[model samples]
Target: MEIVRPHSHRNLFSSNDAASAPTIPLYRSAPPLEVRLEDFESFAIDRLRVLKGISDGLSRGKKPDEMEKLVSELWKVNMRHQHASEVLNKDIISHFVLRLVYCRTEDLRKWFLSMECALFRYRFRFLTAEAQRAIMDEFDITCKAVNIMEFESIKEKLGQVARSMGQPLPTGDAIFYKVPFEDVPELVAGRRVLLSQGYAYVAMNQVVSLVATLFRSQLSKTLILTNRKWTSSIREQEKHRLTPIVEALCSSYLGPDFSQPKEYAEISLKDIDQLAKTSFPLCMRHQFDKLKEDHHLKHGGRMQLGLFLKGVGLNLDDALAFWRAEFSKKVGLEKFEKEYAYTIRHNYGKEGKRTDYTPYSCYKIISSTPGAGDHHGCPYRHFSEENLRAALSRMGVNSRAMEDVMNKVRNRHYQLACTLTFEALHGVPCDAGINHPNQYFNDSQKILQPKKDSST
Candidate 1:
């Protein structure tokens, strides 16, 4: 520990036992560069969880606003989860390449389709006549593409997708009456194409537009709708109300669209982190950048550090440890723990008893965020390309394996990434040893005893 500003008061936990208790490793069991460098998107797996919803519902109009408001209200009520949500919304999406891989069997996949349609059709229903025909045409192309194999399984899955889309059958010519929306002239007689096709970029456009609209309306009323000559008291009232609304407006503006309605929730962390570097709040990036430069860390490393600190409900001591390990070699520990550590901790979430906590492990690092400060997770701009390469190299990975994993992530193969990484690391399936990263970490803490160099 760095020499402190000597205090006349003896400290509470700074005794020999405290120092001897083994300062929790700020970098224990840190996988080698190879293990840590699984495509940057891996860091975003949990952080971008909320984007899946934002990405999907963004196309809806008034409803997405209501949804967002509801989410905001939920955050207000469960302040404990706020940090986690923020992590998901901003931090995770900014870094990881999150995606959904369709790896279901034909019949099962079809059932999945039915479930989705049943769930989302009210908001983004079956395709319209023009769009349906277009989809059918595309379906023909897809079918042709699948001639590589029997593709019967794919055919069934496509049929499921069609059904989920509210199409009665596969987007193919079946021996049945093709019920085109064109057939129901009355359906379109007055509905001004109230919505667009499913394949359209619906989510970001719609949600963002609605949020934009409501935000603007609220802003105009609160900030600009006044006669400039209002009394001081009235102006004060307006200012008080306007401030929060304005902030919400700015947030909504930054948020994804709610109108266009398509959810390609393939979180591309590299892209988003770059955006954070270029566009996010300045105070945020410093915390992670410090970690990166000092620790030779990558984007994932920064994210992991942020996430673990957040997850463990780290107090001032642990928070200080984090910066000490990451930045001491560069700036010295005193500067961080006394100055930066407190700032980072305060930003992480509320400190004190009954605070939100999750296991500090790869899983939580990958999947925990509460959207507000209560539940912690995420470090700003923590990971970048260079550090990521180093971390992956240490983890027994190479350019070829990294390439394979990254490609899989780009293709939205979440499960496959987990499966492949596990196989590569353990020479066995993940199920062979432990089920989840949480389980692995719990066991590792016991099995992989703290080394002389490791933190307790």
Candidate 2:
């Protein structure tokens, strides 16, 4: 394997003449090149935007024509914004930078790998046949095209299987990939294609699904291995290089921006009840309701609601007081202090790990499973259809809006349901995807508050 080490102090792509230019590798490494912090952040954000757009497009279930247009639009935007000649280099570098930002924890790591694989699948699927062959060679993926003669011989069997799986078998004009039969469990389980002596004959249209699975698995393993090698020495050397760039990228769009306290400070514990009724996402709203009505919450509910309250500018003292007041109603003052005070302080970074825990993102909340008696997870995902509809109805979501949101939920687009919920409550289109709970809160505030008037 060729390691793509960038020259210490030069442009990755300088010459316009292809014959004279160096061959860029499939992946690029970060060089010890000095750059303005702004430029570094801009590059990473541009790539992040592309990744996010891909994720959003997938969630919407775009058709082939729409998907092609979307990818082309994203590509043009990225290329126009950056040096067009070094598009590949910029893409590779930004990916590595984001890996640093998102690799700090397990949830971030899963999300990064998932989105990156989807982006790769889109790009790979759109490549010309010759281009696909080159990439396959570069990546050492053993998958190969099944020629017309081979496909013709097996077309009948393939068609039979495809029909059984409720998928169409491609004609001779379409390409087929001969991959190991064991690799594509989705296709295999669906009986979507024929398996020969050892290979699964997958249609060109379905190839992306297989590639994405393999890509995500390989990339996930690589991240885990690389994380192990990221020792103190490596972090010390790359802290300046990696930390600021990732932080700026994340803070700008992907995650919470803790530096901006004024926005969150607009609301306090005093207004939480009213605000929960109006602004909180259904998951948090349910937790708040249960906390108030029952005067107790399971561990999961406490963690979910506690961090959200913290994100909404509830200070350590205020959080302690709020929980103490609520819990003391049932547990009494002494038991509340002994049993709950320390945990609340720990959430606020006053005890235990001392790590300032960020509130759960929409991805984290929806992906988590709530057990019996727990009301902490995304309602759209965890609730039964009847239960979810009832919950939404109680929250004043109109029937039409409830139907639309539930359709997305039935399709397992939980995040999109949350996005629709944002739209329903705020009465405006939220163009950006809803990925984090704090983001939902912030967006609600932005829409609810007048631009000229900060006095909420």
Candidate 3:
């Protein structure tokens, strides 16, 4: 395994040469040279944010144009660069770092591969013809260009396929490639290209799909090999230093901290019931309902719901009063004060470590393991199919909406299912998708309580 040193401090490609260079990377090389601990973590986290943006857009069923717009905005924000070399080096180092982080599990590998493929396709589609050709040549992708004589014979069939895809027929001199159907299954499956015998006639505009297929195949194998190397050959000391970072990245929440309440109306104990009905996410609502019915919640439910309420503007006084009011019903005031008051105060940063813990994001909630009788984790992830269906029905999701949400759930896209549930209940698309419980609550409030214009 050859180690490739990252040229982050110097330019690998001159500015004049950037236009024709293949800026989109294949990541076929080994891991980059040693980076500082801080750089290593920050680079990986930033790249993960980009990948998550892509995943969220796709999961929410954004159309191709919408997804492209979303990804472009994300790239500009998270991956802005002053020079082409800087961009390529950061891209390379970040890809290798995330491979280490995501290679540990099958689910993680699938997610990374999917998002990376999407990223590759986005870059490939936007590149100049020369740049795309350079990448194809670099990868040794052999697709025979259809000659004029051969193209003339198939032009009508190809035009029909293009028209079906809502594209106009290419000019007489337009280029098409003849590749095995297996090389571009997505185009074949979508019927976006003409297929005759075993070969598929892919239009030049649709070549990104073929390149993306290759990237996915290569990256999938790399991730498995990375996992094997990670577990078996890496030095024990290196693993000791890096494993914690990998684990943290896997479960880390990169969103804004929701420890402090946003600028919303202050929530009192009396408003809790109404808010739970109209504004709370399903996880919090489930905990709220359980607490109301049972007069108490175990530790897991308390922490989950407690931090969420704190994030929603329930100050310390109201938090303590709210918990005590219900808990006292079961444990009596003496025991409640002794056992439960401290934890509530601690969550408010008034006792113990006074850490002021942030509310759990969807990532954290979904990653959590809830034991039997606990209603702390994400419902979309933790609920059985029958239970999820019943929960959606209770939320007044229509039959069609239920099917859409259930389909996302069946595909193991729990967050997407949650986003669909939000859309179905609210009657609007969750454009950014639901990343945090607080985000869902805030979005719901924006809809349910539209602010009045003071000037008016």
Best by lDDT: 3
| TM-score of candidate 1 on Cα atoms, chains taken together | 0.28
lDDT of all predictions, in order shown? Answer: 0.34, 0.73, 0.84
Question: Which regions of candidate 1 fall more than 4 Å away from where they truly are?
Answer: 1-304, 309-319, 344-393, 398-403, 414-419, 431-456
State the local distance difference test value for candidate 3. 0.84
- Worst 10 contiguous positions by lDDT, candidate 3: 1-10
The digit string of per-residue lDDT tens for model 3 on 66-151 reads 88888888888887656545776677778888998899889899888888988989978888987887888877888878999999
Deviation in Å, model 3, residue 387 alpha carbon = 4.2
Itemize residue pairs with steric clashes in candidate 2.
none
Q: Count clashing residue pairs per candidate.
A: 66, 0, 0
RMSD of each: 23.2, 8.3, 3.4
Top candidate on TM-score is 3
Q: Give lDDT tens digits, candidate 2, residues 1-456.
A: 112235333455546643443232333334433444455566678777777788788777778778778877886787343345556556555666677667666877887887877677767777776666665565567776898899889988888877887776667787888988888887888777679998898886677667666667767876776566554445665676655555455545455544224475745768878888777888998899889998989899999888888887778888888888889999999999998999988877779888887787776687688889999999988989998888788778888898889999988888889888788867898766687777788788787767427774
Q: Positional deviation of 398 in candidate 2, in angstroms?
A: 1.5
What tens-digit string does per-residue lDDT give for candidate 1 at 315-345? Answer: 4455556556766776577765565554444
- Winner by TM-score between candidate 2 and candidate 1: 2
Residue 181 in model 2: lDDT: 80
Candidate 2: residue 280 lDDT (0-100): 82
